[model samples]
Structures are given as C-alpha cells and as structure tokens.
Target: MKSETYKITNAVVEDIITETSNIKTFVLKPDKGLEFKTGQFVELAVKGLGEAPFTPSSDPGISEKIDMTIMKVGLVTDAMHNMKKGEILGIRGPYGQGYPIDDFKGKRVCVIGGGVGLAPLRSLLYELMHDLSRFEKVSLYYGAKTPKDIVYKNYVKKLQQEKELDLFLTVDQADDSWTGNVGVVTTILEDLNPENSIACVCGPPIMMKFSTLKLLEIGFKEEDIYLSMEKNMSCGVGKCGHCRIGNYYACKDGPVFTYAQIKNFDEIWD
Candidate 1:
C-alpha cells in the first residue's frame, strides 16, 4: 500500500457511548467497508492537529463501520470528544499483523485486558464468540480501576451467560456497591492451567510486565503470550521513527507482538 495517499471517504461519527468519564467509544463509517484482522489498528486524524493510531473495538465481521475506544488523555482525544455525530474525520489503515486466529482452531485461548487496553482485546473476544466451534475453550480476564471504569458492561455479561467460556473481572478499589473481585488483573492468572493455552494480553506497561511474569511462572510459553505495545507513532507507515522500540515500529511491526519477540528490548515494558 502507498503512504500518504489514502482517500478521505466517509468520516461521520456515529454513536458516542461514554464508557467512563475518561473513556468513550466512537463508531465511524468509512466509504468502503474495512476488512481487518483481529489485532490490526488504524490511524485517525483531525486535520492539522495530528493523527494517532487506534485499534478498532468493533468485530472484524462488522466492517461497514469501525469502533474506536478513546481515552481523554491527550489534546487530539480531547478534540475527538467534542466531535458531533455525522462530523467528517480522516482515517487510514487497518494495519499491522493481527492475532493468528486460524492457528487457534480447537486450541484453548486466553485473553487478558485492562483499562482502555480492553478495546482491541474486546474485538478478538467478539470474533472468537462468533466462531465458538473453532476453538476448544475460551477464557477472558478483564480489569479496570473501579467498577465504573469497566467498558462494554452488557457485552461482557452476555459473554458470561451465553458462551461456555470462563469470564473473570477485577477492580483496583471497591466501593460499597462493588461486588466483583478486588485486585489487579494479575490475580486471575492463578486460575489458568497453561498446559495448552495461547494467551494474548493488553494493558498498561506495568500490568503487562507483571502479567508476563505470572504467565511464565504458570508454564505459558513466552512465544504463546502476545503483548500490545504503544510508543509515539506519527505516520502509521514505517516512514516515521517515533514509535520505534529497539528495531521494531509499534505502528508497522505491531501494536500486537508476541512476548518472545519483545523480551530483549529494554525499553519496551517501561
């Protein structure tokens, strides 16, 4: 694909569901449907302000529109919040290597996501749900700062009820109204028997670091554990060097990468 030549098709914003005070899910429809794999990401732009890479939170099957979970942590995201429905925006990509779903056929799958990290992970979970027969057992452990921080509340609930998959959740601090487990996401690592499971994880740098340790201690191979990374990616293509972590570009090489591929990079987990 060529760089800097993408068409500004349709950029209308659809539904805006506030997941939390700092997080919101934006639905966008491009001119043509986006055919993307589970772990791919796209670069969204607001003209002169800049562009940032975001993973699509919607399922791969539903391609007419894309869903992006944005956290209000930066200038561009703050501008995104003020955007109204039907407002035009610019989008490029469906980039990077995604999860190897075909290899997981009839194999156990484990997914761990924390905070806004659940955005990309949620899309994978949804894809697995649609093809339940392809995999043997599916398990998900999702965590957030508090009960209010959890995104896709009803969808997680539905996954628990309908699918045979084991769904676990945790929170940092609990209020009087809170009822789920109280701790970090790593707590759920104890429940998994990693004899034959492929795990994918996405979260803050600290969470990912500790989670990788726990997964390793429990017999999960480093190669079997995938981690999503983020640095400063200006251009989604390999032309820019901002997102480099050692020799790899977070935008081109991955937003999703196996732990084995990144263990040698000193600054990756920091």
Candidate 2:
C-alpha cells in the first residue's frame, strides 16, 4: 500500500552546502526513504516556521539521501537557511506528476533552466546522465543574474567537461573576470535541433514565457515541450485550492505539464 500523503516523516539535515550567497543545498536523510521521480516536490517544514514545496535536487536513484536546493526568499526559507546540520525537520511528500522520462527514449532532450530553477532540472539531468543510452542526445542551457548567482558551480563544471552532453552557461551581465556567454538562456536555443527532440523548461515567469516562445519558434511541438509551473501551493495534496490552474490542480494534476496541456489556460504566461 502507498503511504498517506498527509503523514509527515522526520528527516535529519545530514549536510548543508552553500550553493550561492542566497541559495543553499540541504542534504536530508529521512527516517523512511523517499522514492520520488525526477520532477516531483516535497513539502518541507519546521516546527514553528511554515512549510513550503521544494523539488529534490538530488538524483532519484539515490534513495539514501535527498538534496533540496532552496533560495532565501521568504520567512520559511529564511529560517531554513539559518538551520544547522543535525537539525530535525518534517517532510510530507514526493508529490505531483514528474517528468515523463520513460517516453523520452531514443529522443534528443533539451533542458533549459535559469538561476535556482535549475534545482528540479538537475534531478532530471542526473537521471538522464545515469543512463545515456536511454536518449539520443542531451543538452543543458542555464543562465543566472551574475556569475555569483550560479548554483551547483562545481558540479556544473564537471558536467561541462563531460563529452556525452552539451552544456551552455550564460549570465545577464558579466564581471571583469567573466568571459563566457552573456545573454538570456534562450540565446543558446538557436543552434539546437528541434527535430525528434523534447524541451523541458523551468525558470522565472518571464524567462519561461520567452523560452517557450523561442522553442515554438524553432519548430518544437506544443505537446513535446514540458514546463514546471511554480504555482503557489499551500498543500502538497489537492486539498488546498491555492495551486489551481484553471480546471486543473497544480499540486495534483501537475507541477510538471506539457505546453499543450496548459497553453489554453488564462494567464499562463503571467
């Protein structure tokens, strides 16, 4: 039988790594292992502080521990950043629909992420990396506000050196020491072949909008493009109506959706 969605499990913060000035990756070891798919999220909570949804940055193949990359954005996350290793927290999910990686076999995969949005995409990427033969090709296009804002710097550097995948990085502005591409994430989409390929995108509202437009402009089908919608979710389950997108509940029907699935929804670009 499946576990209850509302049942909270205790987890220990085994390690914490500062990814950027404002973002940190928390490595948590749950009392009971969390078996989650690539794009699913978990509801993490502290006793007094509130809970928020965050996708696991670690690979799903690693059941021993899961990594959550969080940005110090609001009250709950602020408290999370101040939290120390060995502290106990609550985890209540591996919720929502994940990426359809199984259907991607023998097809080229393109991933685009901006800033902390890379967190969820990282999980999918790791799963893809684990078995390169499952796909024809893989490409990653990432962008941040500045070099200092880049998360998972060291790991991304190693991915850049791997000959199996194509990695591209960009920033809105470049410092004196920076010499890489300086533009939006969509700039790299120019050279990618949309034929027999699928695109997965996650980022700020504006970024996701423009990225989707660019992908469509480059011949990718609406059904072939996947998007991670960052709707306001109070509950990981469908009980709360906070994450509703038109007739669908983001928490239940999706957090991961195809462009064809959500393209008709009002204010989707907003």
Candidate 3:
C-alpha cells in the first residue's frame, strides 16, 4: 500500500460534467482501477502543469472510474478546465486517513457542506446510503452562495427524494426564483439532536469555523465533529511541509480529523 501511494498512474479524461459556473466534474479512467476510502484524496496532475490534491467525488464502491469535481481556482485548474476529452492526467494516492465509517456505525451521521466542499461529502453520502441499515439516521445539510452556485443539481434532486435520507439546503443569497432558506447555512442548523450523533464538516475555512461553533452550541462533542482540512496541500505525502499544522501534517495525518484532534492549533483556520 505504501509503495503504490506515491506512484503516479496515467489516467484519461473520459468526460467532464459542468456542475456550476465555476465547478466541473472530470470523469477519469485510469490505466488500472483505483479504489480509495470515501474521504481520502488523490493527487491529479498533467505532465508539466503540476499536481493538486482533490478528494474523488465518486462513490468508493465504483473503482473503475473516478470523478473529481474541481473549481477553476488557479493555474492547474484553469488548464484542466480547458482540457479536451482525450487528454491524460497523472494520478497518485488513496492517501491520508479517510472518514472512519466503521466507528460511525450505529450512530446518527450528519453531513454538512458548503459550496464545492460537498464534493467529498457526496462520496461519503453514497456509502451511507449504500448501507442504510447500519446507522440510525442519515442527513445532509448543505449551502451555497446563491442558488446558481449549488453543485450537483440533478444528483441533489435524487438525494431529496431518498426516503431513508433527510436533506436540507440553504443559500446565502436568493434570486427571484429561489424558494429555499435564504440565509447562511448556520441559519438552518437548528433542532439538531447532537447527542449520540456524529457530524462531518467541510467548506471554506470561515464557514467551517462558524458551523463548528454552531454545532458546539447545539451540544455536539468535539470528538464527534470531523473536519476536512485541505488547505495549501501541495505534496500529498508528508515530505512537503505545505500542509503542516503544528506537529502534525494535514496531508499525511489528516485531511480528515475530529475537532478534538486539531481545535487547539491556532493556524488551523489559516
């Protein structure tokens, strides 16, 4: 497992689905099938353009093809946005620790996401829904800057219709056609039964910070709050200090960690 973690395998871009104005999901077919834990990430790259870390948004159960939902945020992503169907990219990983799904068994699982952060959580949701009998309840609460900014439009519709899952959505700003809650995601976080439940959070650092505070106010324990910290992670392995946080490395020890494992670090939100 350690040997394959750093090896880059070639993958072809089979298709791309435009999710929003800024985000798109790339369907990649690697030379060999790659399997990863739901919340684990892969380092995707072009031969010369360099690599970046991204959590696969596809269900972990399907390893034949990997789906990566990326936003056009920087140079690498901009080039990727312009890539054609036949283009190739390098892939490395299944790295870092993923969501401990086994430990979450028999407990209520709440997933919270904002904007593109939903990409990673979507994979987790798939696994939860795949085996719904393992948990007591499964719920998703997600928010975006505006109705137009919401990713996975059609997929979210199906999520809403799933009888075993509870889904809630909110937008920071609403247009004339928007009918959902018209406030930040925290506005709809009320009435949560934090006891005996576990929550996973991912989003912009500011949104993550405040959402965590809200979860705490509602009585969620720090040990039960998992945060996805994917900031400035250049090299997926531990050698690169780009993702260092105090004594631990986000890309190595985590990208996923419970709140109690990292809340003491002052630079976590940075």
Candidate 4:
C-alpha cells in the first residue's frame, strides 16, 4: 500500500436516497472524483464516530459525485445513516483490485446479488450497461427477504423496460404485491446457460456459498466465477490482519476474487 492510501479526502453529503426500510444510498461530492472502478471499495469516515469500507454503487463512468449504498449494520454505518445532507464525511482510497472488464468481453455475464450485496454489483452493472456491445449477454439475478426489502425497486423496475439486459427477481417470503419467484436467488439461476459465461457474485455468507454452488452445478467453471468477499476489514491496507484469509490479504490482493483463487479456504464463505 502507498502512503497516500491513508490520507483522507473531504466529501460532502449531497443527498441520501432511501432505497429500502433499512438501506440507503448516500450521494457524496468530493472536490474531485474518487474515480473508482466497478468493484473497488473505499473507506468512508464520520468526523468523530469511525470509518468503514464501502464499494461505490454508482456509475463508474461518472466523475463528479459517487454513490455508496449502505445498510445500517454497525457503528459507522449507524452513524452514517443518521447523518444529514451537507454533513462532511472523509473519503479515502479506491482500493483493491476491481473487476477485470476486459476479461468479460465476448462472453456471457451473470451478476448474482442478495440484499445489500447488490450495492457492489450495482457498480459492475453500470459498467457493463454502459457499453452493452462489449459482451455476448448480461443478466442479473437478485433476491431479498421480501418485496418491501428489495433495495432498488425503481431501478430494478426500469431495468425490465430495458431489452438489452435481463432481470430476474425473487423474494424468500412474499406478500400480496409479489409476483416473482419465491425462493433463494439460486432458484433463478436454473434457466441460465452457464456455458461460455462468467458469474460475479456478492451477498451474505450463506448466499455467496449457495450461489457459487449453484453456478458450479449449472456448468460454470470455478475460475470463471468471481466473488466479492466484502469482509469486515478494519483497515484499508493489509497490515491490520483483520481481512487475511489463509495466506492472502483480501484487503491488498482482493475484495474481488475468482472462485478458483479462494475456494480452498474453509472460511471463505464466512
């Protein structure tokens, strides 16, 4: 890691969009762009509370402001959720290896996400959607606890109208308003043509495990599958030892890794 990795930049809260009951998208404007790639993450710090790593959820092409979708899960996130527009937050780094978009060209792509896991994958989607001609096909399979808990309702609805992209949705438990599949996200992977394709997955531990298994069961190669570990990394740099999985430092080597690179680790899914 470089010395500059520890330096924090000032980012002002421009707006906050309530995505679901407990999830929000924070709009932050730094003096300049954070310029992060699709899967790389940054540390967002509250003035006094603390900081946590979050992947940027907005378009990778946009430069002025960045969007980070956060679930109110911990001390830093809880404080961030309570913050108002115009509050100044500290931003540092566009750390770790991002999705290698070039490798995805000329191949079918599947993005699988669960709950807030969609946040990081959302950035990859924007990059893929930016130039649809670069890939053979692109599809998204997502599931949440319920219809109301779905993170990006308007955005998902709009994707349906876009013929270029395929969207399949499901909820574990449904209400009257639900019309999609009602099982785990892996349920939707049954119909996909896993051959000549690559799948990128992010979610809670259980979700990541089954999604990987489902993808493998359906004929996807282990090396062709990508996962965002998104572990509780206390420091953005590898020295903290908080994000080490076996010999690899997930902070420095990857938050995004191919299944073949990490499938041997017993705690990978945890």
lDDT of 2 by residue, 1-270 (tens): 666657788999999999999999999999999999999998999878779999999999987799999999999999999999999989988889999899899999999999999999999999999999899999999999999999999989999899999999999988987889999988878887999999999988899999999999999999999999998877878987899888888888889999999998998867
For model 1, the run of ten residues with the poorest summed lDDT: 1-10
lDDT tens digits, residue span 150-225, model 4: 9878888899899999999999999998887999998998988987899999999899999999889988999999
- Candidate 1 clashing pairs? none
Mark the 10 consecutive residues where model 3 has the least summed lDDT.
1-10
lDDT of 3 by residue, 1-270 (tens): 466546799999999999999999999999999999989999999779889999999999998899999999999999899998989999988788899999899999999999999999999998888899999999999999999999999999999899999999999999998988988889878878997899999998888999999999999999999999977777788887888887788888999999999988888886
TM-score of each: 0.95, 0.97, 0.97, 0.97
Q: Tens digits of per-residue lDDT for model 1 on 1-270? A: 554454444577877888899899999988778888989988888867867778899998988989999998888899998888888778888878888888778788999999999999989988998878888889999889999899988787797796478889899988888888999999877978887788989988899888999999999999999898877767767777788877788878887888898889889887
Residue 30 accuracy (lDDT) in model 3: 93
Candidate 1 Cα RMSD (Å): 1.5
lDDT of candidate 3 at residue 221, scale 0 to 100: 96
Q: What is the lDDT for 4 in model 2?
A: 67
C-alpha lDDT values of all predictions? 0.86, 0.91, 0.91, 0.90
